[model samples]
Structures are given as C-alpha cells and as structure tokens.
Target: MGVCFSTIKVSGSNSNNNVNHNRKEATKQQTKTTKATAPTRKKQEVVDHQQNNKNVNNEEEKKLKVKEKQGSKAIPCGKRTDFGYDKDFGMRYTIGKLLGHGQFGYTYVATDKANGDRVAVKRIEKNKMILPIAVEDVKREVKILRELTGHENVVQFYNALEDDSYVYIVMELCEGGELLDRILSKKDSRYTEKDAAVVVRQMLKVAAQCHLHGLVHRDMKPENFLFKSTKEDTPLKATDFGLSDFIKPGRKFQDIVGSAYYVAPEVLKRKSGPESDVWSIGVITYILLCGRRPFWDKTEDGIFKEVLKNKPDFRRKPWPTISTSARDFVNKLLVKDPRARLTAAQALSHPWVREGGSASEIPIDISVLSNMRQFVKYSRLKQFALRALASTINEEELADLKDQFDAIDVDKNGAISLEEMRQVVFSLSNL
Candidate 1:
C-alpha cells in the first residue's frame, strides 16, 4: 500500500508559484550591498598571467585573473551558470516551461541541450536578492546533492550554475505534487499502515547514507520528502539538501533553522547533528500515522514550548486498534534520548513492516494511476484494503508494513499510514 510518486501527475498550476516563493523565502538570504562593478579581467585571468611569468611581483597580484581556460566551462558536480535572468523577472530559464515558483526562484521543465531529455530547472539570483543566505545555501545543496545521486530516497540534480544575476540548477523533476498538498486535500482516506512502513524503510536507508557521508539535512518535512514514482510500486525520495551540512566528524552547527512544526529541539537551540534529521523524520512519520501533526500549536510560542518540552501526545492519537508493537516502534523513534532511539537500520528491521516476517519487496505498481479518476478508484481500493488488513496482520509486523503502504499511496490522502493501520487494528480488537 505504499504511496507511489508515479500515481500522481499534477498538471503544472499557477499555485506552483507559491511553492517557488516558499523555496525562495526559505533559501534566499540577505546579501551585503556593494557598488556594482563592471566585469574586469577575472581573477582567473591574472592567475594564468602569473603562471607564464614568475618574475612578477608576488606581493600585489590578485586571484582568478588568468587567461580563460576552455576547461572552465562546467565542473562535474561543481556549480556552473549557463542561464541568465529576464530583465524584469530577475532570473530566466530558457529551456523549459515554468512548472513551479519558490519565494526566490522559479522551477522549470527544462530540456538538457546536451542529452535531449527534459529536466527541472530551479532559478536563483545571487547578488540582488534580498535574502543573503540563498547563494551559499544553494551552493552547498548542489555539492551535497551531486554526491547523493544514486540513493533511492534523494532527488537527482545535474548542472548547477551561477550567472551574473542568478543561479540555475537543472535536475530530475518529480511531477507529482507535494505529499503535504495531498494530505491537506482530503482526497485520500483509506491508506494503510502497510503503506507507511515502506516509506519509512526507504527514508531510513537514505538517512543512514547521509549520516555516513557526514551530511545532515537540517530541514526534514513532508515537502522535503518527495515521491519519485507516486505509486505503491515505487518509493519516496528525500529532497532539498539546501539546509544540509557536511560537518567534520563530531562537529555541530549553531544556526537556528528548519520548519517550525518539524524543527527539533536541538535545531531551535542551535545545537544539531544527524539526529536533528532523525527528529524531523519522526515528526513526519507521526504526521503520516495521524491525520494531524503530533505537536500542533496555534502560535509560534506554543510550538516552541511543545518542542522544548519534548512531550508527544500519544494518548490523544486516535489509534485504538494500533498494535502495541507498532506504537512501540514510533515511541522508540520519538524518544528524547538520541542514544536510545533505533538507528535507521534498526527501525527497518521492525516487524510491522515485514510481510509475514520476511523482508518484502517495495510495491511499485501504483505508479500507473496518474489521472483523477485513477486516483479516486485507487482511494476506494485503499480503504477496502485497510479494513481487511487490520484483522489479518501480526502486531509486530506493523512497523515494516506501514511505510510500504505510504510509499505506494503517493497521494498522501491519509488513506495509507502506520496510524491508519493502527486504527483498523483497533477496530478489529474491539470486535
């Protein structure tokens, strides 16, 4: 029952403008104001000149001023700028139709002129934008992203360039809308715990990889976890490494960052590590299980207090049928003791996710239901599936079964999740 990215083919909409704006606002940092200067002999040019003549003054020479090298065209996994901004629009993407807009950039369906395949283009401006952090963040995102290409849960990127006024990132685009959007739409209500288990497994796998690479995704939320195929058959991808960091081993950052609802206590306190991402994953997983966020606050102050307290309302969640073992798994993840919580690998081994105690393959078939009617039918089947699943499953197996369903249900209609399955199990128990 895992949600499949391929199942949801959202037509590009004007509403995407909001998404772009959001990315922009989140990533765009304030830049220092400086007098605009004309293009001078680039420091690369001067460096080249010095290489040919060692008799020059070593004390007063500048950097990057050497003669232009053709190899300077584009560095592999290195940032490059091949596009420019529209005079009025700020940054312009020439190859594709605009698909979405973020606060500081526009995402486009672009064609890779070199390969002839269409790709998504995210545009940004470096010097002019009010947000100063956008430049550095985007740079780090590209660097980290390029290193994570083959992972199943991470999004793939290609050319990342910085132009005169803007920066451009061309990469694989997931056409399915955000999981947050699907959850909010109230169109899906039948997804099962079997679904969520699959997603969790994939996420853990990717998170472990990131942790191994010394990278930590400071921001982890539904919006950041993207669906690759949008069906029960495929898997969900971990997207947006913009706020990520590759700290040297045992190092930490003090930046107060991440989405308010999903931000971990350590993040707000400006002390963080890979565990910060794990906490975020817990919040996202909790949201998947229940219809609402685990820690909900009407005000920013309240939200902060809730996080600081490290208290979660398990008693309030409507999972009367939830198996104790499955609940135990979530409890372990949501634990305040970072040391006590299960590592990604340990979580994947939980029984709720296993099918008959065997490691089952990911369900990728649901990717075919891309249309509205298909989704409607899919939702109906999902509900029916949930009711039947509750009575038949082993309690210990719920953990693994949950994400499997969520990954395939890509629509995120709350029809598939660990909590949803728990509800079904509760019903069975009552009867």
Candidate 2:
C-alpha cells in the first residue's frame, strides 16, 4: 500500500509559530549538545582572543586596524561581499512573501520576471557575516549548489546575486512541505516497505552524487529534504548546504555537525567522512521503516551516547513485519564502524532499497506514525520544560556552582575539559 499525505491544516492556535519556535530551540540545543563531545578548538580560540585583548598595545591595535582595512579592500564586489554573480536582482526577479528566516537572513518566494515562474530566494544579510568563516560558508554553499544542481534529486540553483547589503540565492521553489511534515500528515502515518524503498532510493542517490563530487552533506535530516510539489509522487529534492564541506581523498572532517537524531557515531568522535552521510541516511531509513528514531533519548547527551553504544532495535513491531532484506539494508548502513558501513553507492544496490527489489507492498502498522508524532511532541515538551527550569535559575543562585566549576577547570580557561569531567565522575562514582 502506497502512503498518501494530506495537506497539513493550520489552526488559529498559532501551531506553526510553536513548531517554528521548537525547531529553533532544537537547533540551539543541538549546537550546545554537540559542544560537549566535539573538539574545542573554536572555544580555545575565544579564550585566546580574550587573553590577547589584555596585552594588545595601541600600536598593535592600529596595525591590526590597517590590516583589516587592507583585507576589506582586497575582497571583490565592493566591501566584504563577493558572491561572484551579477547584482541585477531588482531586474531579474520580484520578491514576494517571506517563506522563512534564519540567523543570517530570510527566505522569500520570488517570481522570475522573464518566465513568470516562482522560485525560492535566500537573502543572506552581509552584516550577519560576522566571522570570516561565515562568509566562506555562503560562498562554498553557492559553489557546491552550482556544481551539484545538475542532479535530479538536488534542488535547482537558478542564480546568485549580491548587493552591498545582502546576497540573494534564487532556486527552485518546493511547494510541498518538509519530508517530516509529509510523514506526519499521512492518512494513517504509515508506509509500506515498497513505499519506503522509493524514498530511501532517492536519498541514497543524492548521497551517492554528493560523495561522487567529494562533498559531505554533514546534515541530512528529514527537514533538509522537500518535495518539488504537493503531488503524491513528487520528486524529493535535497536542500540546505550550510553545513556541507568538500573532502579530499583520505581526509576526514573533524567538526561535529548535524541534527541530534541523525548524527553519526564517527561525527561525535570528530573524524567523520562521506560514510557519515550514509549513517545519517541509515537513521532516516530506520525512522521511515519503524516510525521511530533508532537512537534517541530525552537529552542530547544521552542521544549521542545511544548513537555511540547502542545498536538499532529491530525486534519491535514494524521491524518484525518488515522484510529480512530491509532489515539487512538498514543494518549495513548503521554499522558503528564507518569502514564496515555500506557506501552510498553500495547501499543503492542493496536488495531492499534497490529498484524492483524485495520490499513488501504491505503497509506498516499504523502505530508507527503515531509513535513518530508522539516522539516529536514529547521532544518539544521536554525542551520547553528545560527552558522553564533554566529561566528560573539566576546568576546569584549559580555563584556556588561557578566556584566548583572553576576549581575543576585546572587550566583556568573558563571551561572544563572532557578529561577533567571524566576524572571528577570517576572519583564520585567510587564514593
């Protein structure tokens, strides 16, 4: 049985606002959570900057100012903005309603004046490019999209334009909502193994293409994928290249990035590669087949631990009904050792997810969607509760806590190291 999703109805209760708020909170939490496990080079740089601020003389400051001015003038397209594109955004397109907004800028629906076709325009404000790396990330995203947009599954990039204030990236508009929204809007919140195979196959194809081009899509959660239209068989397009980076042969990315549920074990270990993208696909596939996250917990730390230590549970209700080939496909992708895990190309050839494979047409149990919905709701509530708890505490109440933290922070670097925390835990455990 093929799964069909209905258009999501928005009530007057501002449910959309709530959902957006939760998503933002989730993003913030994921960033905070990953810091506990990832390398602290960025943190160390901040500490170094703070320390350097005390010793800098006026002569050094003036020299630094001169260098900054020289660097600014050396850049292209005037000032600090250089998008390598024409700045005729006013002539080419008419911007319409705001689709969404993020830290950098807002996304809007726009019309191509030439053909009267609608497109999505991501307008990134130049002022928000506070860090050099932030500017480079935007440039790289455009470069990658320009290179990879030829693929069927990737979102089509129309043009990149820049002005003194903002950079505009116009691309194909996906009228259909996110993949997660489609799953939640399903009539019975269920998909047959065959239906799942179709979705997974597209995702694997995208992964294969990205890997072929030596790009690692560090973030590949459901929210990053969208249907080109609202049709039942609309082609899914992979979007969002903010966290993506190019990888040379035998090179691995050290930065930990990605959503909590979809992040791979190697990512937490700070040595991720293209295989990590496959791991994320495995996570998505597990959720698709079982309607629940393979690695999950009430806390992000716990979720990371689960991803590192626990194997996905396949003895549950939907898994029992799922085919052996399907189970094997997921197993190979979710392997803890990236070396042992299936490559994107290898996974595309798996018997379960491959075209015309043994995936069953029987619909999975309806409870699968129910579980997924509950999981999302529970996560939001948990985040709300944590926020409430945090808001209740003030700096005065944390004075004693700060003292204890400072004592344990042997380097006096304003942050405790993982080794220091582990030693403390070990001593306490023995007591």
Question: What digit string (tens of lDDT, one per residue) describes model 2 on residues 264-368?
Answer: 999888789999999999998888887789998878889999999999999978788888998999999999999999999999889888899999998788877
Where in model 2 is the C-alpha error above 4 Å? 1-79, 188-190, 378-431
Residue 185 alpha-carbon offset, candidate 2, angstroms: 2.5
Go through the candidates in order and give each one's C-alpha lDDT: 0.61, 0.83
- Model 1 TM-score is 0.58
Model 2 TM-score is 0.72
Backbone collisions counted per model: 101, 0
10 residues in a row with least lDDT, candidate 2 = 1-10
Residue 151 lDDT, candidate 1, scale 0-100? 79
* lDDT tens per residue, model 1, 1-431: 01222222243455456555544554443221121221234655787887757645542243333323223322211234333322422233356687655445677787655556767777764432322233456667788988998876777866676655567777787765666444334354445555566666677778888988888877877666666555546567787676788988767776666777778777666567778777777776666655456675777568877888857766653544445665776777776656676766676677865444432233212221233234335445865776577657653354246446555444454234345677667878999
